[model samples]
Target chain A: MGLPVSQILLVTGFLLILIGIWGILAHRNILRIIIGFSLIDTGIHVVMVATGYVTGGTAPIIDAALGKADAAANAVDPIPSALVVTAIVIGFSVTAIMLSFAIRLYDAKKTLDIDAITDSKW
Target chain B: MKRVCAILAVLMFAAMFLGLVQAYSERQARSPLAEYYLTQVPRELGAPNVVTGILITYRGFDTLGEVAVLFMVAAAVGVLLGSKKEQRAKTSSTDGKGPSELVRTGAEVILPLIFLFGAYVIMNGHLSAGGGFQGGAVVASGVMLLILAMPASKLDHGFLSVTESLAGVLYVSIGILGIIIADGFLDSHVLPLGKFGTLLSAGAIPLISALLGIKVGAELSVVIDRFRS
Candidate 1:
């Protein structure tokens, strides 16, 4: 059975998510964990955009090239794409915050290892 | 032991995703709302890009929230990294060697072009695939180039802050004006929807989008600067 492009995208997105999860769990350095989290964020974006794809559909734009009626029939879902823009910004913001925290932690402790900075752990 | 655990976790995730992929199907216009937007955007908003129309007009509040979130993050990062001691430590650690002549010249030449492209993207948001968010990122990249290529030359933090605040205030004021003069808050019907597919079309959408682009660009620049120091 030939796998659909959407399914292929989904699988790739999921694989990225898994690799990210593994990185976050396996790595001891704080930066590695942050990198993993970003990978997961990217994976989610890919999955979301992929889910909106329609076979043989064009972008959701109306112009002289594509009439309004034809656009409604052929355009892919626009909501996911719109939402993904916001998601991307929010993800960037979160990543920035995490990196700042990492920097502060490194400055204070002089180490990036997660295990070494566990004085607060009970 | 951790390696084994990681492998097991990855395998489990792969299995779960495989199950999901098995049940997935791709089709055109799955949701009724998607159909509605695809149909009504051009007729109502006079814009060709339905995603831009939805982002800046139909669901503007979410976009506002996004801007607010970025603002908060910038603020938080500034506060987190603003310690005088840390600043001194960073400055003292780095040697005073600036970027090479070639890099400086390239950045100087490319910066204006990046700004122009970003402006174009924001201006034509209603008519094409790009919009405020994407354009804002391009603008931020320009700022990033400045930060990297000319680290000695300081960006005017006060100016960036003022621009960000003014753009944010204007965006909200436009929304409030929409509530008074048009259908509702953040409504794009405040201005006459000009010729379809034209730059002037989509009422306040293009305006709001431009403001959003400026705000996002400034906010990201501030964040990057904070991270640098």
Candidate 2:
């Protein structure tokens, strides 16, 4: 194969991070910025899961397909998958908080533009 | 100037990560730690889903912390947008028209199915790809759908919070039970590890998954409900 699935996923995740950063820096709308933040979060999750992949490994589950005896050679790492589960949940909570903040800001200034809030400007 | 900076920053990150492209291609063997979990979880925990076994028992403390973080977010979001804007959000800016008859009818038809599916996912977590968080999200999405269908409907905040807190307390109680009886905190061995690859096979895992599903579903529903207004 030219490139393995894991590497492709890894590269795609990195690209998503860069795109998210550019979106965050270049956008003025708070909603767009939040979307960018979510993109970055997703990118990081992908990278972490990709890092745990083995060359020809299946899921870590020891079902009928992969017996316990063959688990070591056949299974991908479960740690990253478990951590990503936490990461994904935390990411959703953070996104929800960001959205609530965005709405609060919109309510106060009647605008979603970051430039509209002058009190926080350095 | 901002555009140039954005492009330059993206380019810099791209260049920096190019090394990863090469490093990731080589075949990698399982670490000793991974190997340990892979073999031991099935034998010791009797949960076919190794990931769920790890998440619910092995790294249970971290999962507890994650749940705490979600609880805080729900509370913070409540504090942030829960007051003063009720009338505004209730009125809704969408021309005051509710969802269409098709959506309402569809929601009425499929809402129960969605809830059942979420519960199944949570319950069968140890034997399958589903788990508490994923299944809990599925449940919350059902709540979201309910919200979407019935704009004027009100969620029982008191009931949801009670469910969330009660499930959390019970979860911790189970963990403590593990420490008292089994190897350590949140150990699955507290309950008898039944036959492998069945719904009730894993010791305490199905119970934990149920508790997690209930807690997360309640918390996320509260968050979603608060966001409604």
Candidate 3:
């Protein structure tokens, strides 16, 4: 059997997630970690939306020319597409908040290295 | 680096194999809300874009929450960074030579086009792929270009704040109007639906999109202004 587009998208998404995780875990810079977080979010959104796509499905919009039979024949789910828009907005806001925090941290501490940001002795 | 690459390669291979198997096994599974939203929501809400119907009507509370988060972030950033004395001291020390004439001219030429495109995106959202958030981002980027190309001293913080607050209040009030006039909060049929696939159709979707566009545009400009040194 031929490889499905969904499978390919899913595999690429998972790989991107792993890379993002690795970046977050291994990087010393706080900005790098934030970038990693964004990457992970993007990967998850891609996978979530890709899962909604069927092998042979039409766009969600109704066309009168298609008639009832053709409309019922193949149509991909629109719910995930709708949900993904929300997810994207939420992701953007979160990224903005995180970046603002990073800026504040830099302003107070004068450095971006996570290791140097420790205020309390441990 | 080599070890990391190797591990990544192995993980990729494993994930590909697993996804193939999973797709083969789970081919028959169906999403419950998928059909419900597609058929029922359009008929009840009278909005052609099911996505818009779901976002602004069925789950509008979530949209309100998202807008609140953005507002909170803007407020927090302002509070954290708003030290007028320090800013004034810093500005005085610098020579304050304004931006180059070329940059200012370029911004004057480009800003109108950007705003027009943003409006187009918001207006055509129901018919096409884009919506409020994307259009809002585009508008913000345009505002950013102005800040970059013009002198910082020329940027009016008061006007920006007024625009931002008004847009935000309008957004919530529209939702409340849905409650008062239509089914509930953010009901799409609060206004006339016009006809499907047309610019004036989808009732409140275009209105909400325009509101979101303005709010996002103003908020992001404020954010960019905060970081400009």
Candidate 4:
């Protein structure tokens, strides 16, 4: 059995990362740049999770069919799924904090334009 | 100047590519510990997702550091942007109009379902695709809906703070429990592993996921409350 869906997801995730990178480079607004960063983070998470998918593999739980004696016969790798949870939480917190920064920047400068906020006199 | 920057970037990228190729060609075979970890960790940990096991158990110290980083960032943002005087000033000026009827109604209708789905994701973390992060995000989204639908002044700050602190403390305590009760730090097998695919089977993963959900929800709510318009 081939994991065509997983492959597609991986490719799509890569495309999203590329698009997000482009957006980060091209956008002039700080908010859009932050959004691009979020997109890139999400794309990476998708790619990492997709890497763990095994064709015809069952969930990582121990199977009764194989019994306790040989429990490894059917499980797929559970590590990536667990790691992705931490990544997601980190990403959410980061995004929230970044958004807060964006709000503060907007408050200070009265502008969301990235070019307008540059100053060495801080 | 832009063209020069672009050319320099391309050259740097090419150099990195060459460096990566050289490194790959010269890399040694996997170590015995690496092979043992790859083969043995999943079976022993009873978690299907090796990454989850690594994050929550094997390298839990790193995960704790990551949470600290998040908390510090949040605190830094709060300190930098938040002032009692500024908050009071903004509140008076920006008693902004409430959310539209459509948004308010929609959010009210969907928030409970969203929260239930987040709980489901957290509870089934071991057996299914989701884990703490995904469930946490889902819970955060539920709070986001509430923030969008209601006034910031109306938000229950006390409840949010209690939930956040409780979750953070619980997460650390669970890690400590692993050290005290099990083989080492963040050893999830401290609790008895039930038959396997059941909700209670993964020892502490579901518990961690639940704590994560509450922490994320509180954090995101705090973030949203800070931005009133």
Candidate 5:
């Protein structure tokens, strides 16, 4: 058979990470760099989420659909799901902070180009 | 030169990932720790949603730190973008006219339902798939829709900060109560674990979820509003 669904997701996540690295290294605009950072964050989250998958398992909720007994066998990994949940919020917070810094930089330098703001470059 | 360097870096990453590809096969079973959470969360915490149980109760300290990080971001963003100078780079759609009539009407109709759904998601976190984070995002989305519809309207800082701080204080207070009453910090057993699969069940999980939802919603709304300046 072909690669499993989680592998496909993992590959996609890795590709996204590669693309994000390219964006960061190649792009000079501060906004694009922020976008690159966001892409990296998203890629990592996707990978984490994909790692949580079980072959034929369902969500980790303890409803009638997913009975309490042997719930571990029936459900996907709750830890990764939980960690990803927190990670997503952290990612949002970091992105907001990055954008805020970008805005302040743009205000002071009057340009979105990173190379143009070389005051701190040594 | 930058392009070549970028390609080289990407290739390096691809090589590294290729080395790890063998481990990416289908997962066969949960780890022992995952098994413990999947079983004990329901039995001890009485929260149906195992992930929610883990985040709110089992991993409560981490959640507190995460919330603190978010709180710090909101403050930092406000400090960064919130100056007295009154200079702002507008979103390029500025023809001096506000949002379209359709957008305004749609926001008016949908805002209440969005808030209602956010509350539902937060309250039903222990019972279902969503929790404070997702529901709080939904609530902030409603605020975003409002901001989109009325670009010139200003959010009240006084009200937003009050609500955010109140939720945060109450959340920590409940965590302390857990020390006094139950096992340890953020112990959900401070209150009785009412009934299985019911609204008021799951000890303090739903309460914590609601507090988290309100705090996150307010913090995010403040953060989103910060982009206005």
Candidate 6:
């Protein structure tokens, strides 16, 4: 009757990615850039989980109602969700590293302006 | 002009992404491989949660890589910010007033409960929706709360690093044990599969999941400690 929820999620994720990129490009503050990066990471994670969605499927857990034989016809894809779990953790680690770098940069130059830290800029 | 160009570039990227999404035809059980995991995981591994099964068993090596990546990040962050000279110089910056008594009491009261919930999530990972990563993050949040509330309290860096390393070694050893005792590296058949949907079921998956939870929790605590005062 309408576009599936998966497509909607995909679109929403795309929009988030765009917003993140806009933030990164339009903002000069180091904290905002890191925030933009984290947003992009989240958008990617959402798109990943959305890619695995089935039209009318349940979680890929085998229980009383969902037996082994019927699991194939019912369960959503598990691979992407699992990968997304990994992606989310890695994203957090990367964000931490980025923020630490930002802190070090601030400590050195006493500024958070992206343009100001351009000693090596070509 | 640069702002206009950035907007145009982002719009172009969005247009391409929309085109890709429009062409993507959604399906129920799209891949034969996913179908195999869906049906075979329950029967073969006795793990109810196919995602958990696949994460800790089918694609266990990938998970190992992910863990390694996190470990590297933690170490990298430490090296980046853990300078002794900087530590001495930054004492004045971090000596802000402590959190109020109400917040301190609240954190004290809720810390153990948060730990319990994190354990529940980790322990039931093989049988439920939550898993080691989610549980580990929950635990990290509790650690974060303690850091924020007390401010004077310190997480034992030595204990955390030792535990993290020990867990990493144990995880690898389990994988190697699987290669010897079962089909291949990280194979869950190293132990008895027990019964389906039970806590003790799923062979080595639950064990690995627990080890993962501890390892991730420790690593995250280290990251938080490095970032904190």
Most accurate candidate by DockQ: 5
Q: Cα deviation of A66 in candidate 4 (Å)?
A: 10
For candidate 5, write residues A3-114 as lDDT tens digits. Answer: 7878888888888898898889989999999899999999999899899999988989987788999797889998888999888998999899889999999888889998
Give the poorly placed runs of model 3, Cα more than 4 Å off. A62-73, B1-30, B84-106, B151-154
Candidate 3: lDDT over CA atoms? 0.73
Q: What value of lDDT does candidate 2 attain over all alpha carbons?
A: 0.90
Candidate 1: give the clashing pairs: none
lDDT per residue (tens digit) for residues A1-122 in model 6: 69898998998898889889999989999999999998899899889989999988888988888888888998888889988988898889889999989989987998999999889847
Which 10 residues in a row give candidate 3 chain A its minimum summed lDDT? A65-74
Tell me the whole-model lDDT of each prediction, alpha carbons only. Answer: 0.89, 0.90, 0.73, 0.67, 0.90, 0.89
Native-to-model Cα distance after best TM-score fit, residue B65 in candidate 3, in Å: 1.4
lDDT tens digits by residue: candidate 6, B120-206: 999999998888888888999999999888877878989998998999999999999998989999998999999888899999999
Model 5 lDDT on a 0 to 1 scale = 0.90
lDDT of 4 at B1: 68
Compose the digit string of candidate 3's lDDT tens values, residues A1-122: 67777677777776677778777867889999999898889888877867887767666665453332343345667777778887887787788778877878887888999999767857
Query: Which pairs clash inside model 5?
Result: none
Q: Against the hidden reference, what TM-scores do the models get?
A: 0.96, 0.97, 0.83, 0.76, 0.96, 0.95
Give the higher-lDDT candidate: 2 or 6.
2
User: What are the per-residue Cα lDDT tens digits for candidate 4 across A32-71?
Assistant: 9888898889988987766665544455543344343333
Candidate 6 pairs with clashing backbones: none
Candidate 1: list runs displaced more than 4 Å.
B89-93
Q: Report DockQ per prediction, comma-separated.
A: 0.81, 0.82, 0.39, 0.26, 0.85, 0.80
Q: Which model is ahead, 2 or 4, in terms of lDDT? A: 2
TM-score ranking, high to low? 2, 1, 5, 6, 3, 4
Put down candidate 5 lDDT per residue, B33-137, tens digits, no spaces: 999999899998899999999999989999999999999999999889888434464543455788899999999999999999999999999999999999999
